[model samples]
Target: MRLVTYRATVEAEARLGVLVDGTVVDVARIGARAGVPLPSRMLDFIRLGPVAVTELGHLIEEAKGRWPVDGALPLPSVILLAPIPRPEKNVFGIGLNYIDHVAESSRALDTSPELPKQPVIFSKPPTTVIAPGDPIVHRADITQQLDWEVELGAIIGTRAQRVSREEALAYVFGYTTLIDMSARDCRRAGQWIYSKGQDSYCPMGPCIVTADEIPDPQTLDLWLTVNGVEKQRNNTSHMLFKVDELIADISQGITLDPGDIIATGTPEGVGAGRDPQEFLSPGDVIEAEVVGIGKLRHPIVAG
Candidate 1:
């Protein structure tokens, strides 16, 4: 099932929902009607663990393939927000985790082509997150080189610490499409927080496809396009640090809690890697997708 956070109207409260036949079924409402109460917030729902997800699955099945169930709204009529609209902490991002992307970055930056022995991790503050259809702010005064990266976002389901690669995946709740928007010129001291952590720098969602549906996250294909022109396209199989390794490695030191998101590094073809170099300008539209998850389409607006 594709889980999402949506609002019936701009003024309405955000509700947890599931997609069924092009409609958004309110998970909490459905559970309440069925006497199986669930949380309306995404983080709360995830904390309930697999049992809650299993129960929701049963509730969906109980719908019997019919959509627009009681309290359900057509997907188009609702405003879709990030699967986890406001994450509890900074989002962990892996840098240059794709082999080809590594080479491309080396060429663009005139650096070595050698890949990192360990994951190059970074963070983006919660303020950077925006939902699909929202504008990606282009702060022309601060950066003239606004780039784009389409990454697979892995949402943690349960607490994981010192786990092995073999057991890492069990802690993943779901996956979503994410855009790692960057301001090339904002890089300072090799730290990315300021360059990529500005307001509206991250655009995530459409919905989160529960981990059960995507048993093999590595097999999925993800891509990004700007104004209808394809910029990045590759499969998750090419990631230098797979989701399992990332989880296991990170958890070795830091405890990963439910709702913490790891944006698996992006593939090649970012704007900065281009021969002449390209950057987002106001009025540009970006559409990024992770197969089986969903597409995140947003516009670039002047800040």
Candidate 2:
């Protein structure tokens, strides 16, 4: 099932929902109808552990048995928000984890292409998140070298600590599309937090496709388009360090909670790697996706 966080009414707070057949079914309402308990927020729901997800699945089936669910709303009628709009912690990011991305970035930086010995990681503050159809502010006066990186976001299901690569996949709850919006000109060798964590820099979600639905996370295709022009395209299979490794590596040092978003590094084809280089400007529309998850389209607007 594709889980979503959406707002149906203008003044309503975002609510947990499940997308089915272009419709958004209110999870709370359905849970009530099926005599199950569900939280209104994705993070809270996820914290309930796998049993809760299993129960929600059962509830969904129960609701389906009734058909024409009373709480079901047309998906387009609601505003979709990040699967977990305000993650409990900074979003974990991987840098230079794609073989081709490494080469492209190395060339753009005028350096030799040598893969990092371990996973390259960074963090994006919670304020950087924006949902689908929202605007990615283009701070024109500040940085001119804006770039896009489309990545697969893995949402943790249960608390993870010192997990091994073999057992890491079990900690994932679902997957979502993430655009690791960056400011290339802001780079200063050792400084990345500011360049990658600016407000509205992380645009995630159309819906979080439950991990079970994706047989193998690394086999999914992901891509990005600027306006109508396709720019970045690659499969997760190309990632140098797969999702399980990243999770296992990160968890060894820090505890990962439910709803934590780990944006697996992006593949090649970014604007910064172009022959003459390119950057985003106001009025640009970016459509990014990870197949089987969903698509996220947002506009770039001047601040």
lDDT of prediction 2: 0.89
The models' CA-based lDDT, in order, is: 0.91, 0.89
Model 1 ranges with Cα > 4 A deviation? 65-70
**Candidate 1 per-residue C-alpha lDDT over 1-303 given as tens digits, one digit per residue, 9 for 90 to 100:** 899999999999998998888988988888887888789889999999999999998988987455435579988899999888999999999999999989999999654699989998999999999988999988889999999999999999999999999999999999999999999889888778999899999899989999999999999999889999999989999999999999999999999999999999999999989988998999999999998899989999999
The per-candidate count of clashes, in order, stands at 0, 0
lDDT of 2 by residue, 74-183 (tens): 88799888888888799999999999989999999654599888999999999999989889999987789889999999999989999999999999998999999999
Q: What's the lDDT for residue 67 in model 2?
A: 42
Structure candidate 1, residue pairs in collision = none
lDDT for model 1, please.
0.91
Residue 239's C-alpha lDDT in candidate 2? 89
Q: For model 2, how many clashes?
A: 0
